[model samples]
Target: MDEYFERRKRMVERLKDELKISEKVAKAMLEVPRHLFVPPHMRREAYNDYPLPIGYGQTISAPHMVAIMCDLLDLKEGERVLEVGTGSGYHAAVVSRIVGEEGLVVTVERIPELAETAKKIYESLCYDNIKVVVGDGSVGYEELAPYDKIYVTASAPKIPVKLLAQLKNGGRMVIPVGDFVQHLYVVDKDEYGRVKKRSWGAVRFVPLIGEEGFED
Candidate 1:
């Protein structure tokens, strides 16, 4: 446990320097027990700063990518955040830590099995504010519309129009768009309802599967 803690510290340092993440995001990364979110067989590699398979054909994003997306979302306390993929629940845990008690994190997983696994993890982590639901993430969770921040862990053909509608004015969403090659895109909706987008270079992620995403 001590060694994992040390490795997490070092990983955060590297992420701050390499990914240019803020101090707050770095702290959240260190605080989340990443090992708990990884498979027991792969726990030793939990803090390696690389993506690890979590079964069900899904993989957690590398730490660098996680930090970059979190930075792009610019989450604030008490803000509602919608995560398009729960995976191992690590990213949602990190977001939960940042959101604290007041804020809510609604994470949707397409696989029933993964959603069940994530629900248990959330209970163990005592993330009462986080909700793990089994559904089509590409369509966006409408029950809790108007999210302050939205993040899609998988790559899509294009930003889902449904998701954009879910974002509150002045909110932001981070998603990777493309087929063979993907580019990380940061989209922001302004106070006046105007949207601006910027690319954060190439990235690779599992194709987001659903009506708005690529055919699985």
Candidate 2:
């Protein structure tokens, strides 16, 4: 336990120096025990700054990427967030820490196995503010529409219009768009419901498979 804590501390420090992530994001990342989200065999590498395969061809994003996305969204306490891929649920756990008890994280995953595992992890860690649902994430979880912030962990050929419609006015979404190559984009909806987009930089992510996304 102490070893994992020390590794996590070092990982966060490196992320802060290298990416210049915000204090809030760093704090959230530091508080989440990433090892709990990984497969038992890969727990030793959980804090390393790289993606790791969880299962079903899905991956848990690197810690730096998680920090970058959270910083871009400008997550705040009491704001609800929608995460479009639950993978290992590490990202959601970190976001839950930042959002606090007053806020909520509604994360959607396509695979039931991953969702169940993530749900169990959240319950075990007492991350009660997070809700995991199994569904097609590309269409966005509309049962609770208009979130304060949204993010997609996979790459899409284009910005899924369904997701854009679910962004509350003044909300922000960070997603990666492309086919063979992808770039991270920050999409914001203004108070008047006007949408604007800008690219953050190139990034590679597994393809998002579903309606409004690449066909499986």
Candidate 3:
């Protein structure tokens, strides 16, 4: 356990430097046990800086990418965050820790089996603030409307307008958009219904499949 923590600490340090995130976010990365969210077979590679396959045709986002996106979202304690594509539940777990009990993290996974497994992991880890739903994530979770922050893990051909509607005033959303190649898009909505969009860089992710996402 000591070695595992040490490795994660080092990884977090590297992430802080590489991703240019605050120390608080770096600490969150270190504190969240990535190994617990991964499969036992992949536990040894948990601290690696790259994404790892987590069954169900999904892969956990790389640490650097996660740090970059989280930092870009500018998450704060007690903020309501919506996460599209829970994948292995690693990202949601990280957000759960950062947001703490006062905050709420609603994560949507399109696959039932993956949602079930991730729910078990969240329960075992005692992340009571996170709510996992098994359904099409592109439409956004309506019951938990008006999120302070939104993150779309899967790449889509374009930003989901429905998701934009769910963002509170002055809220931000990070999404990867494209087909063969993707770019990280940061979108911000203001009180007057004006939106600002920016591109971080190129990235590749599994296609976000559903209404408001890819056609196929």
Candidate 4:
């Protein structure tokens, strides 16, 4: 655990130097034990910048990607956040720390196995602020509609209106949009419910598959 903690500090340093991530995001990234979310065999590489496979043909988003998304969303303490893809639960775990105890992180996972594993990992870490839900994440989780912020870890054919509708007024969302060629987008919803978006840069992510996303 001490070794992983040191690795996290180094990782955060790189993120700050490379991406200019905020202190809040950096602290959250450093605090979450990424090694716990990954499979036991892959724990050694947990603090590395790249993504690692977590079974079920899905990969955890790279540490850099997670840091960038969290920065884009501008997550604040006591805010409600929605994560479209739970994956290894590492991303959600980082988010949980930023949001703090008053805030909530509802993460949706398409694969039942992955969702179950994520839930177990959250329990082990005593992360009560995050809830792991098993469902099609493309459509967004309406039960907790109107999130203060939202982020999708996968690439979609286009921005899902369902997800946009779930973003609270004056909220932000960051997602990867496109098929063969994906680009990261930062979407903002104003107080009047108007939405504006701009491309951040190109990125590669597993396809978001469901009703409002790619055809599975």
Candidate 2 TM-score versus the reference = 0.98
Candidate 4 lDDT trough over 10 residues, lowest sum: 1-10
Give the range where candidate 1 is weakest over 10 consecutive residues by summed lDDT. Answer: 16-25
Q: Report clash pairs, candidate 2.
A: none
Show the colliding residue pairs in model 3: none
Q: Put down candidate 3 lDDT per residue, 34-124, tens digits, no spaces.
A: 9887889988899998999888788988888888888889899999999999998989888888888999999999989888988998898
TM-score of candidate 4 relative to the true fold: 0.97
Residue 5 local lDDT, model 2: 95
Query: Largest lDDT belongs to which candidate?
Result: 2
Tell me the spans in candidate 1 whose CA falls farther than 4 Å from its real position. Answer: none
Give Cα-based local distance difference scores for all models: 0.91, 0.94, 0.90, 0.93
Which of 3 and 4 is ahead in TM-score? 4
Q: Which regions of candidate 4 deviate over 4 angstroms?
A: none
lDDT of 2: 0.94
- What are the per-model numbers of colliding residue pairs? 0, 0, 0, 0
Q: Could you estimate the TM-score for every candidate?
A: 0.96, 0.98, 0.96, 0.97
Using lDDT as the yardstick, the better of models 1 and 4 is 4
Q: How accurate locally is residue 211 in candidate 2, as Cα lDDT from 0 to 100?
A: 95
Give Cα distance to truth, residue 47, candidate 4, Å: 1.1
- Candidate order, lDDT descending: 2, 4, 1, 3
Q: Which one wins on TM-score? A: 2
